[model samples]
Target: MEQKEKQILVSIISSIVILASYSLYVYHKFMAGNPGIINDFRFWGRAFLILIPVAIMAQIIIHIIFAIIHKIVTDEDLSTKNDERDKLIELKSIRISHWLFTLGFFLSMGSQAFGKPPWVMFITLICSGFIASIASEGAKIFFYRKGL
Candidate 1:
Protein backbone atom coordinates (compact mmCIF):
# COMPACT_ATOMS: atom_id res chain seq x y z
CA MET A 1 0.00 0.00 0.00
CA GLU A 2 1.00 3.62 -0.45
CA GLN A 3 2.32 5.80 2.35
CA LYS A 4 -0.85 7.87 2.37
CA GLU A 5 -2.99 4.75 2.67
CA LYS A 6 -0.84 3.51 5.52
CA GLN A 7 -1.07 6.85 7.27
CA ILE A 8 -4.85 6.87 6.96
CA LEU A 9 -5.09 3.37 8.37
CA VAL A 10 -2.86 4.28 11.27
CA SER A 11 -4.92 7.40 11.96
CA ILE A 12 -8.16 5.41 12.03
CA ILE A 13 -6.66 2.76 14.30
CA SER A 14 -5.24 5.34 16.66
CA SER A 15 -8.53 7.20 16.83
CA ILE A 16 -10.46 4.01 17.57
CA VAL A 17 -8.04 3.01 20.30
CA ILE A 18 -8.11 6.40 21.98
CA LEU A 19 -11.91 6.60 21.75
CA ALA A 20 -12.29 3.07 23.13
CA SER A 21 -10.02 3.85 26.05
CA TYR A 22 -12.02 6.98 26.83
CA SER A 23 -15.24 5.01 26.63
CA LEU A 24 -13.89 2.38 29.00
CA TYR A 25 -12.72 5.01 31.43
CA VAL A 26 -16.15 6.61 31.44
CA TYR A 27 -17.78 3.22 31.95
CA HIS A 28 -15.44 2.42 34.83
CA LYS A 29 -16.20 5.76 36.42
CA PHE A 30 -19.89 5.05 36.12
CA MET A 31 -19.44 1.59 37.64
CA ALA A 32 -17.52 3.10 40.53
CA GLY A 33 -20.51 5.34 41.22
CA ASN A 34 -18.84 8.71 41.36
CA PRO A 35 -21.05 11.63 42.31
CA GLY A 36 -22.93 13.09 39.34
CA ILE A 37 -21.59 16.51 40.16
CA ILE A 38 -19.83 17.85 43.21
CA ASN A 39 -21.56 21.17 43.68
CA ASP A 40 -19.25 22.08 46.53
CA PHE A 41 -16.54 24.47 45.47
CA ARG A 42 -13.82 22.65 47.44
CA PHE A 43 -14.61 19.25 45.90
CA TRP A 44 -14.97 20.66 42.38
CA GLY A 45 -11.69 22.45 42.82
CA ARG A 46 -9.85 19.29 43.85
CA ALA A 47 -11.52 17.08 41.25
CA PHE A 48 -11.17 19.20 38.09
CA LEU A 49 -7.82 20.64 39.15
CA ILE A 50 -6.43 17.12 39.40
CA LEU A 51 -8.18 16.18 36.16
CA ILE A 52 -6.53 18.95 34.11
CA PRO A 53 -3.08 17.43 34.43
CA VAL A 54 -4.43 13.97 33.77
CA ALA A 55 -6.09 15.16 30.56
CA ILE A 56 -2.92 16.86 29.39
CA MET A 57 -0.88 13.75 30.11
CA ALA A 58 -3.31 11.59 28.20
CA GLN A 59 -3.04 13.89 25.14
CA ILE A 60 0.76 13.77 25.35
CA ILE A 61 0.72 10.00 25.46
CA ILE A 62 -1.62 9.82 22.48
CA HIS A 63 0.62 12.10 20.43
CA ILE A 64 3.65 10.02 21.41
CA ILE A 65 1.91 6.87 20.23
CA PHE A 66 1.07 8.52 16.89
CA ALA A 67 4.68 9.65 16.52
CA ILE A 68 5.95 6.14 17.15
CA ILE A 69 3.57 4.65 14.64
CA HIS A 70 4.49 7.22 11.98
CA LYS A 71 8.19 6.54 12.54
CA ILE A 72 7.67 2.83 12.11
CA VAL A 73 5.51 3.01 9.01
CA THR A 74 6.84 5.96 7.01
CA ASP A 75 10.02 6.16 4.92
CA GLU A 76 10.91 9.67 6.12
CA ASP A 77 12.76 10.11 9.40
CA LEU A 78 10.53 11.20 12.25
CA SER A 79 12.62 14.28 13.10
CA THR A 80 12.46 15.40 9.45
CA LYS A 81 9.46 17.52 10.24
CA ASN A 82 6.26 18.87 8.89
CA ASP A 83 6.26 20.13 5.30
CA GLU A 84 4.26 22.87 3.57
CA ARG A 85 1.52 20.39 2.80
CA ASP A 86 1.26 19.51 6.45
CA LYS A 87 0.88 23.16 7.35
CA LEU A 88 -1.76 23.70 4.72
CA ILE A 89 -3.67 20.65 5.85
CA GLU A 90 -3.53 21.91 9.42
CA LEU A 91 -4.78 25.31 8.35
CA LYS A 92 -7.69 23.76 6.51
CA SER A 93 -8.40 21.60 9.49
CA ILE A 94 -8.58 24.67 11.72
CA ARG A 95 -11.09 26.25 9.35
CA ILE A 96 -13.18 23.11 9.52
CA SER A 97 -12.90 23.12 13.30
CA HIS A 98 -14.24 26.65 13.43
CA TRP A 99 -17.38 25.69 11.55
CA LEU A 100 -17.89 22.58 13.70
CA PHE A 101 -17.53 24.55 16.92
CA THR A 102 -19.99 27.16 15.69
CA LEU A 103 -22.50 24.48 14.81
CA GLY A 104 -22.16 22.82 18.19
CA PHE A 105 -22.42 26.11 20.03
CA PHE A 106 -25.58 27.21 18.23
CA LEU A 107 -27.23 23.81 18.58
CA SER A 108 -26.52 23.80 22.31
CA MET A 109 -27.90 27.31 22.65
CA GLY A 110 -31.07 26.33 20.82
CA SER A 111 -31.61 23.48 23.26
CA GLN A 112 -31.42 25.93 26.17
CA ALA A 113 -34.84 27.26 25.12
CA PHE A 114 -36.13 24.34 27.19
CA GLY A 115 -34.97 26.29 30.30
CA LYS A 116 -32.14 24.35 31.89
CA PRO A 117 -29.67 25.99 34.30
CA PRO A 118 -27.51 28.46 32.37
CA TRP A 119 -24.23 27.21 33.85
CA VAL A 120 -25.02 23.59 33.02
CA MET A 121 -25.99 24.48 29.46
CA PHE A 122 -22.99 26.72 29.00
CA ILE A 123 -20.51 24.16 30.24
CA THR A 124 -22.08 21.40 28.16
CA LEU A 125 -21.96 23.59 25.07
CA ILE A 126 -18.31 24.43 25.65
CA CYS A 127 -17.27 20.84 26.12
CA SER A 128 -19.24 19.57 23.15
CA GLY A 129 -17.91 22.38 20.96
CA PHE A 130 -14.36 21.53 21.94
CA ILE A 131 -14.83 17.86 21.12
CA ALA A 132 -16.53 18.71 17.84
CA SER A 133 -13.64 20.97 16.86
CA ILE A 134 -11.10 18.25 17.52
CA ALA A 135 -13.09 15.69 15.59
CA SER A 136 -13.55 18.08 12.69
CA GLU A 137 -9.83 18.74 12.53
CA GLY A 138 -9.09 15.05 12.51
CA ALA A 139 -11.60 14.42 9.78
CA LYS A 140 -10.28 17.30 7.71
CA ILE A 141 -6.71 16.07 7.99
CA PHE A 142 -7.66 12.54 7.07
CA PHE A 143 -9.76 13.58 4.12
CA TYR A 144 -7.19 16.01 2.77
CA ARG A 145 -4.37 13.52 3.03
CA LYS A 146 -6.25 10.50 1.78
CA GLY A 147 -8.32 12.21 -0.95
CA LEU A 148 -11.82 11.12 -0.01
Candidate 2:
Protein backbone atom coordinates (compact mmCIF):
# COMPACT_ATOMS: atom_id res chain seq x y z
CA MET A 1 0.00 0.00 0.00
CA GLU A 2 2.34 2.68 1.22
CA GLN A 3 5.94 3.02 0.08
CA LYS A 4 7.08 2.12 3.56
CA GLU A 5 4.96 -1.00 3.55
CA LYS A 6 6.26 -2.03 0.15
CA GLN A 7 9.84 -1.49 1.21
CA ILE A 8 9.35 -3.48 4.36
CA LEU A 9 7.74 -6.37 2.51
CA VAL A 10 10.45 -6.41 -0.14
CA SER A 11 13.16 -6.32 2.48
CA ILE A 12 11.63 -9.19 4.40
CA ILE A 13 11.13 -11.36 1.31
CA SER A 14 14.59 -10.74 -0.04
CA SER A 15 16.11 -11.55 3.31
CA ILE A 16 14.12 -14.76 3.50
CA VAL A 17 15.21 -15.77 0.02
CA ILE A 18 18.84 -15.09 0.70
CA LEU A 19 18.78 -16.93 4.00
CA ALA A 20 17.01 -19.89 2.43
CA SER A 21 19.52 -20.14 -0.37
CA TYR A 22 22.40 -19.93 2.04
CA SER A 23 20.89 -22.62 4.26
CA LEU A 24 20.37 -24.90 1.30
CA TYR A 25 23.92 -24.35 0.18
CA VAL A 26 25.15 -25.25 3.64
CA TYR A 27 23.03 -28.38 3.70
CA HIS A 28 24.21 -29.42 0.26
CA LYS A 29 27.81 -28.92 1.21
CA PHE A 30 27.33 -30.95 4.35
CA MET A 31 25.69 -33.77 2.43
CA ALA A 32 28.59 -33.71 0.03
CA GLY A 33 30.99 -34.13 2.94
CA ASN A 34 32.35 -30.64 2.72
CA PRO A 35 30.81 -29.83 6.15
CA GLY A 36 31.85 -26.18 5.80
CA ILE A 37 31.33 -23.63 3.06
CA ILE A 38 34.63 -21.78 3.23
CA ASN A 39 36.81 -24.85 3.50
CA ASP A 40 37.18 -24.53 -0.24
CA PHE A 41 37.60 -20.79 -0.58
CA ARG A 42 39.20 -21.12 -4.02
CA PHE A 43 36.11 -22.83 -5.38
CA TRP A 44 33.82 -20.44 -3.51
CA GLY A 45 35.70 -17.47 -4.90
CA ARG A 46 35.17 -18.67 -8.44
CA ALA A 47 31.57 -19.53 -7.71
CA PHE A 48 30.97 -16.13 -6.17
CA LEU A 49 32.39 -14.46 -9.25
CA ILE A 50 30.14 -16.52 -11.50
CA LEU A 51 27.11 -15.87 -9.32
CA ILE A 52 27.36 -12.10 -9.51
CA PRO A 53 24.60 -12.09 -12.08
CA VAL A 54 22.35 -14.05 -9.76
CA ALA A 55 22.99 -11.57 -6.99
CA ILE A 56 22.19 -8.70 -9.31
CA MET A 57 19.02 -10.40 -10.43
CA ALA A 58 18.00 -10.92 -6.84
CA GLN A 59 18.40 -7.20 -6.17
CA ILE A 60 16.45 -6.31 -9.28
CA ILE A 61 13.71 -8.68 -8.25
CA ILE A 62 13.50 -7.06 -4.85
CA HIS A 63 13.09 -3.63 -6.39
CA ILE A 64 10.60 -4.86 -8.90
CA ILE A 65 8.51 -6.51 -6.23
CA PHE A 66 8.55 -3.35 -4.23
CA ALA A 67 7.46 -1.36 -7.24
CA ILE A 68 4.60 -3.72 -7.93
CA ILE A 69 3.48 -3.58 -4.33
CA HIS A 70 3.64 0.18 -4.34
CA LYS A 71 1.52 0.36 -7.47
CA ILE A 72 -1.04 -2.04 -6.11
CA VAL A 73 -1.30 -0.33 -2.77
CA THR A 74 -1.33 3.33 -3.82
CA ASP A 75 -2.48 3.09 -7.46
CA GLU A 76 0.37 5.45 -8.26
CA ASP A 77 3.20 5.24 -10.77
CA LEU A 78 6.39 3.88 -9.30
CA SER A 79 8.99 6.36 -8.15
CA THR A 80 11.95 6.29 -5.84
CA LYS A 81 10.79 6.72 -2.27
CA ASN A 82 13.27 6.44 0.55
CA ASP A 83 13.79 8.24 3.81
CA GLU A 84 16.63 9.03 6.17
CA ARG A 85 15.36 6.65 8.81
CA ASP A 86 15.58 3.69 6.45
CA LYS A 87 19.09 4.63 5.42
CA LEU A 88 20.18 5.15 8.99
CA ILE A 89 18.89 1.75 10.05
CA GLU A 90 20.57 0.06 7.12
CA LEU A 91 23.88 1.81 7.79
CA LYS A 92 23.84 0.87 11.44
CA SER A 93 23.00 -2.73 10.62
CA ILE A 94 25.90 -2.87 8.17
CA ARG A 95 28.26 -1.47 10.77
CA ILE A 96 27.18 -4.13 13.23
CA SER A 97 27.63 -6.78 10.57
CA HIS A 98 31.16 -5.59 9.85
CA TRP A 99 32.09 -5.58 13.50
CA LEU A 100 30.71 -9.07 13.99
CA PHE A 101 32.67 -10.30 11.00
CA THR A 102 35.86 -8.75 12.28
CA LEU A 103 35.39 -10.34 15.66
CA GLY A 104 34.80 -13.68 14.05
CA PHE A 105 37.92 -13.33 11.96
CA PHE A 106 40.00 -12.57 15.01
CA LEU A 107 38.49 -15.51 16.88
CA SER A 108 39.36 -17.77 13.99
CA MET A 109 42.93 -16.60 14.11
CA GLY A 110 42.94 -17.15 17.83
CA SER A 111 41.96 -20.75 17.24
CA GLN A 112 45.36 -21.25 15.70
CA ALA A 113 46.87 -20.97 19.15
CA PHE A 114 45.03 -24.14 20.05
CA GLY A 115 46.51 -26.09 17.09
CA LYS A 116 43.35 -26.17 14.97
CA PRO A 117 43.55 -26.53 11.22
CA PRO A 118 43.71 -23.13 9.62
CA TRP A 119 41.14 -24.04 7.01
CA VAL A 120 38.67 -25.39 9.55
CA MET A 121 38.95 -22.37 11.76
CA PHE A 122 38.67 -20.04 8.82
CA ILE A 123 35.54 -21.71 7.53
CA THR A 124 33.97 -21.93 10.94
CA LEU A 125 34.65 -18.29 11.51
CA ILE A 126 33.08 -17.27 8.25
CA CYS A 127 29.93 -19.30 8.86
CA SER A 128 29.61 -18.05 12.41
CA GLY A 129 30.23 -14.50 11.32
CA PHE A 130 27.58 -14.62 8.64
CA ILE A 131 25.04 -16.11 11.00
CA ALA A 132 25.83 -13.64 13.72
CA SER A 133 25.59 -10.67 11.40
CA ILE A 134 22.27 -11.78 10.01
CA ALA A 135 20.93 -12.49 13.47
CA SER A 136 22.07 -9.13 14.75
CA GLU A 137 20.42 -7.26 11.91
CA GLY A 138 17.26 -9.23 12.31
CA ALA A 139 17.20 -8.42 15.99
CA LYS A 140 17.72 -4.76 15.25
CA ILE A 141 14.84 -4.70 12.82
CA PHE A 142 12.65 -6.52 15.29
CA PHE A 143 13.47 -4.10 18.03
CA TYR A 144 12.89 -1.12 15.79
CA ARG A 145 9.51 -2.45 14.79
CA LYS A 146 8.62 -3.18 18.39
CA GLY A 147 9.24 0.45 19.32
CA LEU A 148 12.44 -0.14 21.18
Candidate 3:
Protein backbone atom coordinates (compact mmCIF):
# COMPACT_ATOMS: atom_id res chain seq x y z
CA MET A 1 0.00 0.00 0.00
CA GLU A 2 1.08 3.53 -0.67
CA GLN A 3 1.73 5.97 2.13
CA LYS A 4 -1.48 7.88 1.48
CA GLU A 5 -3.58 4.76 1.54
CA LYS A 6 -1.88 3.57 4.68
CA GLN A 7 -2.45 6.93 6.31
CA ILE A 8 -6.13 6.92 5.39
CA LEU A 9 -6.49 3.38 6.71
CA VAL A 10 -4.90 4.44 9.96
CA SER A 11 -7.27 7.41 10.14
CA ILE A 12 -10.29 5.19 9.64
CA ILE A 13 -9.10 2.80 12.34
CA SER A 14 -8.32 5.60 14.76
CA SER A 15 -11.71 7.16 14.21
CA ILE A 16 -13.46 3.87 14.88
CA VAL A 17 -11.47 3.24 18.04
CA ILE A 18 -12.00 6.74 19.36
CA LEU A 19 -15.73 6.77 18.70
CA ALA A 20 -16.33 3.28 20.04
CA SER A 21 -14.39 3.83 23.26
CA TYR A 22 -15.93 7.25 23.81
CA SER A 23 -19.45 6.00 23.27
CA LEU A 24 -18.88 3.11 25.67
CA TYR A 25 -17.44 5.46 28.26
CA VAL A 26 -20.37 7.81 27.99
CA TYR A 27 -22.87 4.97 28.14
CA HIS A 28 -21.39 3.56 31.31
CA LYS A 29 -20.38 6.78 33.00
CA PHE A 30 -23.57 8.74 32.56
CA MET A 31 -26.34 7.21 30.48
CA ALA A 32 -26.33 3.86 32.22
CA GLY A 33 -26.65 5.52 35.58
CA ASN A 34 -29.51 7.77 34.51
CA PRO A 35 -31.32 6.63 31.42
CA GLY A 36 -33.51 9.70 31.67
CA ILE A 37 -30.52 11.84 30.91
CA ILE A 38 -30.73 10.75 27.28
CA ASN A 39 -33.57 13.17 26.68
CA ASP A 40 -31.89 16.00 28.48
CA PHE A 41 -30.80 18.73 26.08
CA ARG A 42 -28.10 19.86 28.46
CA PHE A 43 -26.66 16.39 28.64
CA TRP A 44 -26.63 16.02 24.89
CA GLY A 45 -25.14 19.45 24.44
CA ARG A 46 -22.41 18.73 26.95
CA ALA A 47 -21.65 15.45 25.28
CA PHE A 48 -21.38 17.05 21.86
CA LEU A 49 -19.22 19.86 23.16
CA ILE A 50 -16.91 17.54 25.02
CA LEU A 51 -16.72 15.09 22.16
CA ILE A 52 -15.53 17.67 19.62
CA PRO A 53 -12.35 18.62 21.47
CA VAL A 54 -11.76 15.08 22.61
CA ALA A 55 -12.05 13.74 19.08
CA ILE A 56 -9.75 16.39 17.65
CA MET A 57 -7.11 15.88 20.27
CA ALA A 58 -7.32 12.13 19.99
CA GLN A 59 -6.97 12.25 16.21
CA ILE A 60 -3.88 14.39 16.54
CA ILE A 61 -2.31 12.13 19.09
CA ILE A 62 -3.17 9.02 17.14
CA HIS A 63 -1.75 10.43 13.93
CA ILE A 64 1.47 11.41 15.68
CA ILE A 65 1.80 7.94 17.06
CA PHE A 66 1.11 6.48 13.61
CA ALA A 67 3.78 8.67 12.09
CA ILE A 68 6.36 7.55 14.63
CA ILE A 69 5.54 3.88 14.24
CA HIS A 70 5.47 4.13 10.48
CA LYS A 71 8.86 5.82 10.55
CA ILE A 72 10.37 3.17 12.75
CA VAL A 73 8.89 0.35 10.70
CA THR A 74 9.68 1.67 7.23
CA ASP A 75 12.47 4.14 7.94
CA GLU A 76 10.57 6.62 5.83
CA ASP A 77 8.93 9.89 6.76
CA LEU A 78 5.32 10.25 5.71
CA SER A 79 4.83 12.96 3.17
CA THR A 80 3.90 16.23 4.78
CA LYS A 81 3.36 18.23 1.62
CA ASN A 82 0.44 18.13 -0.71
CA ASP A 83 0.82 18.60 -4.43
CA GLU A 84 -1.97 19.18 -6.93
CA ARG A 85 -3.21 15.61 -7.05
CA ASP A 86 -3.20 15.40 -3.30
CA LYS A 87 -5.15 18.63 -3.08
CA LEU A 88 -7.68 17.39 -5.58
CA ILE A 89 -8.16 14.11 -3.73
CA GLU A 90 -8.60 15.92 -0.43
CA LEU A 91 -11.11 18.31 -1.89
CA LYS A 92 -13.11 15.53 -3.46
CA SER A 93 -13.18 13.48 -0.29
CA ILE A 94 -14.12 16.51 1.74
CA ARG A 95 -17.00 17.19 -0.60
CA ILE A 96 -18.21 13.67 -0.06
CA SER A 97 -17.95 14.04 3.72
CA HIS A 98 -19.77 17.37 3.62
CA TRP A 99 -22.69 15.98 1.66
CA LEU A 100 -23.02 12.95 3.91
CA PHE A 101 -22.98 15.04 7.06
CA THR A 102 -25.49 17.44 5.59
CA LEU A 103 -27.80 14.57 4.82
CA GLY A 104 -27.38 13.32 8.36
CA PHE A 105 -28.16 16.75 9.75
CA PHE A 106 -31.40 16.86 7.80
CA LEU A 107 -32.24 13.34 8.88
CA SER A 108 -31.73 14.29 12.50
CA MET A 109 -34.11 17.20 12.07
CA GLY A 110 -36.54 14.92 10.35
CA SER A 111 -36.45 12.60 13.35
CA GLN A 112 -37.50 15.50 15.55
CA ALA A 113 -40.17 16.45 13.03
CA PHE A 114 -41.57 12.95 13.31
CA GLY A 115 -41.94 13.37 17.09
CA LYS A 116 -39.02 11.13 18.02
CA PRO A 117 -37.27 11.71 21.29
CA PRO A 118 -34.28 14.05 21.48
CA TRP A 119 -31.93 11.13 21.99
CA VAL A 120 -32.88 9.78 18.61
CA MET A 121 -31.84 12.96 16.94
CA PHE A 122 -28.56 13.06 18.83
CA ILE A 123 -27.79 9.46 18.01
CA THR A 124 -28.64 9.99 14.38
CA LEU A 125 -26.34 12.96 14.20
CA ILE A 126 -23.51 11.05 15.84
CA CYS A 127 -23.93 8.10 13.52
CA SER A 128 -24.00 10.35 10.51
CA GLY A 129 -20.81 12.10 11.57
CA PHE A 130 -19.03 8.83 12.14
CA ILE A 131 -20.21 7.42 8.84
CA ALA A 132 -19.20 10.55 7.02
CA SER A 133 -15.69 10.43 8.48
CA ILE A 134 -15.23 6.85 7.51
CA ALA A 135 -16.67 7.39 4.07
CA SER A 136 -14.36 10.32 3.44
CA GLU A 137 -11.30 8.33 4.41
CA GLY A 138 -12.48 5.38 2.39
CA ALA A 139 -12.96 7.62 -0.61
CA LYS A 140 -9.40 8.84 -0.27
CA ILE A 141 -8.08 5.33 -0.20
CA PHE A 142 -10.13 4.39 -3.22
CA PHE A 143 -8.99 7.37 -5.16
CA TYR A 144 -5.38 6.70 -4.34
CA ARG A 145 -5.62 3.06 -5.31
CA LYS A 146 -7.41 3.89 -8.53
CA GLY A 147 -4.74 6.46 -9.41
CA LEU A 148 -7.23 9.25 -9.49
Candidate 4:
Protein backbone atom coordinates (compact mmCIF):
# COMPACT_ATOMS: atom_id res chain seq x y z
CA MET A 1 0.00 0.00 0.00
CA GLU A 2 1.12 3.52 -0.63
CA GLN A 3 2.00 5.92 2.14
CA LYS A 4 -1.09 8.00 1.38
CA GLU A 5 -3.25 4.93 1.67
CA LYS A 6 -1.69 4.11 5.01
CA GLN A 7 -2.30 7.64 6.20
CA ILE A 8 -5.94 7.45 5.12
CA LEU A 9 -6.38 4.16 6.92
CA VAL A 10 -4.87 5.58 10.04
CA SER A 11 -7.20 8.59 9.81
CA ILE A 12 -10.23 6.38 9.42
CA ILE A 13 -9.29 4.20 12.35
CA SER A 14 -8.44 7.14 14.58
CA SER A 15 -11.70 8.86 13.76
CA ILE A 16 -13.72 5.79 14.62
CA VAL A 17 -11.86 5.23 17.85
CA ILE A 18 -12.09 8.86 18.89
CA LEU A 19 -15.79 9.09 18.16
CA ALA A 20 -16.70 5.82 19.84
CA SER A 21 -14.61 6.43 22.94
CA TYR A 22 -15.75 10.01 23.31
CA SER A 23 -19.37 8.98 22.87
CA LEU A 24 -19.08 6.31 25.52
CA TYR A 25 -17.35 8.70 27.84
CA VAL A 26 -20.05 11.29 27.41
CA TYR A 27 -22.83 8.77 27.83
CA HIS A 28 -21.39 7.35 30.99
CA LYS A 29 -20.42 10.69 32.42
CA PHE A 30 -23.65 12.54 31.76
CA MET A 31 -26.51 10.58 30.23
CA ALA A 32 -25.96 7.48 32.35
CA GLY A 33 -26.40 9.47 35.51
CA ASN A 34 -29.70 10.89 34.33
CA PRO A 35 -31.31 9.66 31.18
CA GLY A 36 -33.42 12.75 31.25
CA ILE A 37 -30.36 14.76 30.38
CA ILE A 38 -30.59 13.44 26.85
CA ASN A 39 -33.68 15.52 26.35
CA ASP A 40 -32.00 18.68 27.42
CA PHE A 41 -31.20 21.01 24.53
CA ARG A 42 -28.42 22.60 26.54
CA PHE A 43 -26.78 19.24 27.02
CA TRP A 44 -26.87 18.53 23.31
CA GLY A 45 -25.56 21.97 22.50
CA ARG A 46 -22.73 21.63 24.93
CA ALA A 47 -21.93 18.15 23.74
CA PHE A 48 -21.71 19.29 20.12
CA LEU A 49 -19.59 22.29 21.01
CA ILE A 50 -17.20 20.30 23.14
CA LEU A 51 -16.97 17.47 20.66
CA ILE A 52 -15.72 19.77 17.85
CA PRO A 53 -12.59 20.95 19.68
CA VAL A 54 -11.99 17.59 21.29
CA ALA A 55 -12.17 15.80 17.95
CA ILE A 56 -9.87 18.32 16.28
CA MET A 57 -7.27 18.08 19.05
CA ALA A 58 -7.50 14.32 19.20
CA GLN A 59 -7.11 13.95 15.43
CA ILE A 60 -4.05 16.19 15.43
CA ILE A 61 -2.46 14.22 18.24
CA ILE A 62 -3.26 10.88 16.63
CA HIS A 63 -1.81 11.99 13.30
CA ILE A 64 1.30 13.26 14.99
CA ILE A 65 1.75 9.94 16.77
CA PHE A 66 1.19 8.04 13.55
CA ALA A 67 3.79 10.15 11.78
CA ILE A 68 6.34 9.42 14.49
CA ILE A 69 5.70 5.68 14.41
CA HIS A 70 5.72 5.60 10.64
CA LYS A 71 9.05 7.39 10.55
CA ILE A 72 10.54 5.05 13.12
CA VAL A 73 9.37 1.93 11.30
CA THR A 74 10.00 2.95 7.69
CA ASP A 75 12.95 5.31 8.06
CA GLU A 76 11.28 7.55 5.49
CA ASP A 77 9.17 10.65 5.74
CA LEU A 78 5.64 10.69 4.44
CA SER A 79 5.21 12.96 1.48
CA THR A 80 3.38 16.18 2.19
CA LYS A 81 3.29 17.32 -1.41
CA ASN A 82 0.21 16.95 -3.54
CA ASP A 83 0.30 16.58 -7.29
CA GLU A 84 -2.53 17.21 -9.71
CA ARG A 85 -3.94 13.73 -9.33
CA ASP A 86 -3.83 13.93 -5.59
CA LYS A 87 -5.55 17.30 -5.63
CA LEU A 88 -8.24 16.00 -7.94
CA ILE A 89 -8.86 12.98 -5.76
CA GLU A 90 -9.05 15.16 -2.70
CA LEU A 91 -11.53 17.46 -4.37
CA LYS A 92 -13.74 14.57 -5.38
CA SER A 93 -13.71 13.11 -1.90
CA ILE A 94 -14.50 16.47 -0.37
CA ARG A 95 -17.45 16.87 -2.71
CA ILE A 96 -18.77 13.53 -1.57
CA SER A 97 -18.38 14.53 2.06
CA HIS A 98 -20.12 17.82 1.50
CA TRP A 99 -23.13 16.25 -0.18
CA LEU A 100 -23.44 13.54 2.43
CA PHE A 101 -23.38 16.07 5.24
CA THR A 102 -25.93 18.22 3.45
CA LEU A 103 -28.26 15.29 3.10
CA GLY A 104 -27.79 14.40 6.70
CA PHE A 105 -28.64 17.92 7.73
CA PHE A 106 -31.85 17.79 5.75
CA LEU A 107 -32.74 14.42 7.15
CA SER A 108 -32.17 15.60 10.69
CA MET A 109 -34.41 18.56 10.13
CA GLY A 110 -37.01 16.33 8.55
CA SER A 111 -36.97 14.11 11.60
CA GLN A 112 -37.73 17.09 13.76
CA ALA A 113 -40.45 18.19 11.33
CA PHE A 114 -42.00 14.75 11.62
CA GLY A 115 -42.19 15.12 15.38
CA LYS A 116 -39.19 13.06 16.38
CA PRO A 117 -37.52 14.01 19.63
CA PRO A 118 -34.67 16.46 19.72
CA TRP A 119 -32.31 13.70 20.71
CA VAL A 120 -33.30 11.77 17.62
CA MET A 121 -32.42 14.74 15.46
CA PHE A 122 -29.14 15.20 17.23
CA ILE A 123 -28.25 11.55 16.88
CA THR A 124 -29.16 11.64 13.22
CA LEU A 125 -26.91 14.60 12.69
CA ILE A 126 -24.01 12.96 14.50
CA CYS A 127 -24.40 9.73 12.57
CA SER A 128 -24.51 11.66 9.32
CA GLY A 129 -21.29 13.49 10.12
CA PHE A 130 -19.54 10.28 11.04
CA ILE A 131 -20.76 8.53 7.93
CA ALA A 132 -19.67 11.44 5.78
CA SER A 133 -16.17 11.34 7.21
CA ILE A 134 -15.85 7.63 6.65
CA ALA A 135 -17.25 7.84 3.17
CA SER A 136 -14.90 10.66 2.25
CA GLU A 137 -11.86 8.68 3.33
CA GLY A 138 -13.17 5.57 1.64
CA ALA A 139 -13.61 7.54 -1.55
CA LYS A 140 -10.03 8.70 -1.40
CA ILE A 141 -8.84 5.15 -1.01
CA PHE A 142 -10.98 4.01 -3.92
CA PHE A 143 -9.79 6.81 -6.12
CA TYR A 144 -6.20 6.09 -5.33
CA ARG A 145 -6.55 2.38 -5.93
CA LYS A 146 -8.44 2.86 -9.17
CA GLY A 147 -5.75 5.26 -10.42
CA LEU A 148 -8.11 8.20 -10.51
Which has the greatest TM-score? 4
Total clashing pairs in model 3 = 0
Judged by lDDT against the true structure, how good is candidate 2? 0.63
Estimate the TM-score of every prediction.
Answer: 0.56, 0.59, 0.97, 0.97
Q: Rank the candidates by TM-score, best first.
A: 4, 3, 2, 1
Computed on alpha carbons, the lDDT of every model, listed in order, comes to 0.59, 0.63, 0.94, 0.95
Off by more than 4 A, model 1: 1-16, 30-55, 69-76, 116-127, 130-135, 138-148
Point out the worst 10-residue segment of candidate 4 by lDDT: 30-39
The sequence of per-residue lDDT tens digits that candidate 2 reaches over residues 1-148 is 4445445556656766765686577457543665554466666555446445665688688788777876797788765655676667667667777777777877787788778765657466646555665665575565357533
Between candidates 1 and 2, which one is better according to lDDT? 2
Alpha-carbon shift of residue 116 in model 3 (angstroms): 0.6
**TM-score of predicted structure 2:** 0.59
- Candidate 3 structure quality by residue, lDDT tens digits, 4-105: 888889899999999999999999999896989988999999999999999999999999999999999999999998999999999999999999999999
Candidate 2, run of 10 with poorest lDDT = 1-10
Residue range 1-148, candidate 1, lDDT tens digits: 5454445455545555555565466447642465544234454355446545665576667666766877777645445356777667767766777777787777668767777545455456546645665575566557665864
Using lDDT as the measure, what is the rank order of every candidate, best first? 4, 3, 2, 1
lDDT for 112 (candidate 1): 79
At residue 96, give the lDDT of candidate 3: 99
RMSD of each: 4.7, 4.4, 0.8, 0.8
